[model samples]
Target: MPGPDLLSSQGLRLDGRRPNELRRIKCKLGVFTQPDGSAYLEQGNTKVLAAVYGPHQAAKSKSSTDGVVVNCQYSTATFSTGERKNRPRGDRKSQEMSMHLRQALTAAIKTELYPRSQIDIYVEVLQADGGAYCAGVNAATLALIDAGIPLRAYACACSASMAWRAGQPEPLLDVGHVEEAAGGVVLTVAALPNTGSIALLEMSHRLHMDYFDVVLSRAMQGCRDIEIILDRAVRDHLAEGWTKQDIVTI
Candidate 1:
């Protein structure tokens, strides 16, 4: 079976976006007071929250003298998806997500600046329509910035899928849950959009070798577009947070 249609007659996705357009992104930093840093991110229907704690000492076993140790925990709310009733974390799927989150974040942080220290990041998915992991990575990057951590550049993630439009292969950006469940090949990329260096690349299914480059490029371009949104959010956050209070003499 070719499966359900992922595109409209007008060349829009199920979510009504152009082939290369990303879902709406909105983010805020310092969403919590307890954690060293916190952030919330929304990408279409997917929502993620991230908290960062510690540049504190690492356990001797996990400590590294060459760079900072990065630890990540990934969890999804029980009601995050349509299906309910299950554990949220410590499961096989969560464990795998944790490792992938760590990989993308470690690449952005200037770990060399904090040798023998540890930075712990936790990500929670509040809702998922698609690209939960990508939202997680972007949220963690903002949390790191709010924590005053040094970074070579911001880390951003995006996904791409192929759809048939006018009988031509059209690369879709920011695959949603529907497209993801459609059995299409989904290519996910995490990268430093400024430097255009990939931190992580993953594919859910096989794609033709001939069309592989086009799909990958679309995902990377999505990452870059996401970076622009995130950077603006950070700057706006700084402006609001660092405002100077006027003092008057009585």
Candidate 2:
């Protein structure tokens, strides 16, 4: 059976926002200095951290002549989800996610610029409310920027869901786990928002072809919104110049 009506008669969602509304986004770049680059991002209750390393020579087996090799690893913290994860990495699920992350990021990076070199990106999910993959992608994008990697555009990802309530078809932006678990159709998209190019798209459940356009558009909008938030965070981090404050006396 369908879950509780996701949209009330007042046109507000369970989180008390309009259908196109997105949750609050908080992000920080260069969160870890030990890595070449790193960033932390939080979207609603979902939190993710990403670290980037290299642009250096690839290991013996992974080297390529035509383009740079991008190695990616995705792992979830043991306590990230409601149910604890026993391992942080090497699991089948993490392995698959790592592949997907590599695929998505390769599309945005200008790999040919660093032929025979390599870039390593590692993403860790600190909290998983929903849209963990999307959050990871966004965080990794920022970390790449902090690492000074050239890219075609800012890569962003977001999720959308269809909530038909009161005979109206409403699209939810940036779905949370509660909304995702409701059995509604979910459409996830990773895109270069500035260029309006889609890098990855996946759909869960079923929705009429007519609704595809609406849901896809909503997800794209969410991606664009997320890009703005990330851009602002990057700028803020640069402006702040070391979050730690210490008195200086001459």
Candidate 3:
């Protein structure tokens, strides 16, 4: 159970969104020329930049004969949040986030095709209002595509939270910072919506079993919606004749 005042009398969230609405997502691919692929994405106030390098030779210690190695590094800028603390990239939290990122991305990548190779993905959070991990996953997916990596399907991520409106349990989609801070159950999901598969699922706080399905379903729906948005962005990028070497913006 969360704080009772999560929703307004009219059933709107703190950011004036309905229970099933996602924040506006704006993204651009090929934002940089140095990396093989790069992208910048914004989900409301949350912004992330991702860069992907190689399918090049892997170091002996980290190389795998059976498949390509996917290495990820997740970091938050010093000023990303209001706290403005000097957060080290090798800290425990960043390491965990990096592992989670690698898991979600490896699920989409066709690693078997590039055996004995290595791919590096670096994600940096420029701003975080909530759902920063999800944003990082989304941005990294685009960067991988820009790098011309093969994937089983698009990797999309979204989050959900539980709240009540009109005496009925309502699942909030694409939770923002305010809702997250309200002390409710927050569920984050990363999925391949086109393939009907989930890559990762995480939750903060306990939720009733009865409401669990509903929340999960809502998060999946959000992933599906995000997939559409990302697909459109890809199409538009192609239509604009974007090349990985070209400097472009959208």
- TM per candidate comes to 0.94, 0.93, 0.97
**lDDT by residue for model 2 over 53-152, one digit each (tens)?**
9899999899998899999999999999999889999999899889878888999999989988999999999999999999999999999998889999
- Determine the C-alpha RMSD for candidate 1 after optimal superposition of all C-alphas: 3.3
Question: Candidate 3, overall lDDT?
Answer: 0.93
lDDT of each: 0.90, 0.89, 0.93
Best model per lDDT: 3
Reference-based lDDT, residue 143, model 3: 97
Q: Candidate 1, 173: how far from true, in Å?
A: 0.2
Model 3, residue 12: distance off in Å is 0.7
Which stretches of candidate 1 lie above 4 Å from their native place?
1-4, 242-250
Candidate 2: misplaced stretches above 4 Å? Answer: 1-4, 241-250
Q: lDDT tens digits, residues 56-173, model 3?
A: 9999999999999999999999899878858748888889999999999999999999999999999999999999999999999999999999999999999999998777899999
Clashes of 1: 0
Q: How well is each residue in 1-250 modelled by candidate 1, as lDDT tens digits?
A: 1322677889888878899999999999988877888899999999999999989999899999999999999999999999993999999989999999999999999999989999999999999888999999999999999888999999999999988777777889999998899889889899999888999999978777888899899999999899999999999988885411111111
TM-score of 2: 0.93
Instruction: List the candidate 3 regions with Cα displacement exceeding 4 Å.
Output: 247-250
- By TM-score, rank the candidates, best first: 3, 1, 2
Q: How close is candidate 1 to the true structure, as a TM-score?
A: 0.94
Ten residues in a row with the worst lDDT in model 1? 241-250
Highest TM-score against the true fold, candidate: 3
